[model samples]
Structures are given as structure tokens and as C-alpha cells.
Target: MNAAIHEFTAERLAGGDQSIGAYAGKVLLIVNTASNCGFTPQYEGLEALYQRYRERGLEVLGFPCNQFGSQEPGEADEIASFCQKNYGVSFPMFAKIEVNGDDTHPLYRYLKKAAPGLLGSESIKWNFTKFLVNRQGEVTARYASATSPEAIAGDIEKLL
Candidate 1:
């Protein structure tokens, strides 16, 4: 297994592939998001956290996923537009990627192994599942779909 998250890369929602290494030394809240899920509203809370702690080095990275209930069915453009218009999301958003099964993104694969879910399960259960990584690129914690972004502020504060 890779030693740190900086070893991975993902496609940006807008265009082009981005190296995760670019975010080295910055705390990351990586989340598997969806456009039609109940947790979709969490975008606002996530943006709030980003705005609050961004200058302090906190980055909320949103990765759209369709593995759960096919909740995210739009193309990259649609997803980007929806996030901006509905929630005014300004954080980095990535192209839709599979969170489970054979096609799971490498970044997610590392995250699951670094911080398994309840009962040591590595499979992501659903959309909006979050993984917190420290500035050193170490996977620190994993939050469930129901856990609100606001609830993670205290944890983020410590890392910052």
C-alpha cells in the first residue's frame, strides 16, 4: 500500500487530471457525494466548513459517486452546475467515480484501507461517506453518511 494520500490522483470535475500531491500539507475532508441523495444538502455545511477553515489549510474535496442507488446520474458539467447553483459550492469537486466494485477509484481504495468503517468493513456503504486526512496525508478518521459536516469542525480544528 502507498504510504500517503499524495500518491494518488483524480480527475477534476471541470477538466483535467489533478495530482493529489498538490494538496500536500493541507488537511483534507474527502467525501463521496451525490446529487440526488438525502445527504446532498450537506454541500452547504461542507462549503461552510471550507470557508471557515480554508485559509487555515482545510480543503473539502467532493467526489461525486453513483454506486449508491444511482443517486448521481449527471455528467460532470451538470453536476458542477447543480452544486454551484443550488449550494454555491466552491470547494474542489471531482468527476463522478465509482466508490465500490471493481472500478473503485484508487484514492477511495486507499482511504477505505487506511480507515475501515464499522466492524472493519472497507467497502463504502453509501453516498456522503467522509474520510478525514491530516496535513501529513495520513488518513485519520472516517465519518458515516449521516454524520453532518458541521459535526466534524472540532476534529478539523485540531488538525489545523
Candidate 2:
């Protein structure tokens, strides 16, 4: 497992700390999400993808972030409610976090470093930016916010 990623811990929306290390051997799709963003609807696609591949070892982790235009301004409970009510998001959703700036979560910092964006930029350009991690906890690819979750299914199948 990648030491950097495994070393981080995040609070689950359900009110508990979860060690990233616990997901060491699972393929992971880590996304920085926003409830009110235009790509918010991607939650449906993401949920579909997760449901389809979760039994095959895929884990879609969502981290709500309000850093983008105050789009995800709800508290953990509210965010959880919105996701369940609107998209039936059943995968693990984490407490709100900052995906960019000085307070960026350690996991996100490592992710950006592991998979820099176009032209080697490390900053997350928008919400829903995704980091695909292999079973060994290595960031294999970074998908832009505009890339639909379904569009990455084939690639995920290869990793599986």
C-alpha cells in the first residue's frame, strides 16, 4: 500500500474516524464532491458504478467539499440526507473537507501529488475531481470533474 495514502484518516459522515489504511487492498475511486454543483447529478452515476463493482472490490469514497463556490455548504448530516434523498448514495461519504488550500486534507494532498492534473498542475480545479487508486493504494489516474463516472467504468474493470 502507498504509505502516504494509508497514513491518513478521515471522519465518516456517520460520526466516526476511519483509517484509510483499512482500504489498503481495495480499488478506490476517491472524489471531492459538492452537493450543489452542476455535476451533482453525477452522484447517480457514481452510485450506479459503485453498486455494479462494489462486490468486485471497488470502493467509491465521497468527500463533500464546499470549497467550490459554496456549493456543498451543508453539515455532515445534511449532506448525508441530500445524497440519500436525491441519489440514494450508499457508498461511504466522509465529513466535509477542504480539498484545496492550506488546510487541504492529508489524503487529498497525497492524491494531488501522486496524480497531478493536466500539464502537471497539482491543484484540484473543481469539485467531483476524482483520483483512481489501485489495490495497492497507488493513485493511478486523475479524472477531471467533467468526466462522467460511467465513462470510467471500463478502466475500473481493468483494475479489478
Residue 54 error for model 2, in Å? 0.4
Tens-digit per-residue lDDT, 77-149, candidate 2: 8999999999999999999999889999988989999999999999999999998998988889999999999
Which lDDT tens digits does candidate 1 get at residues 35-95? 9999999999999999999999999999999889999999999999999999999999999
lDDT of each: 0.94, 0.94
Clashes of 2: 0
TM-score, prediction 2: 0.97
Residue 1, candidate 2: Cα error in Å is 4.6
The number of the candidate with the highest lDDT is 1
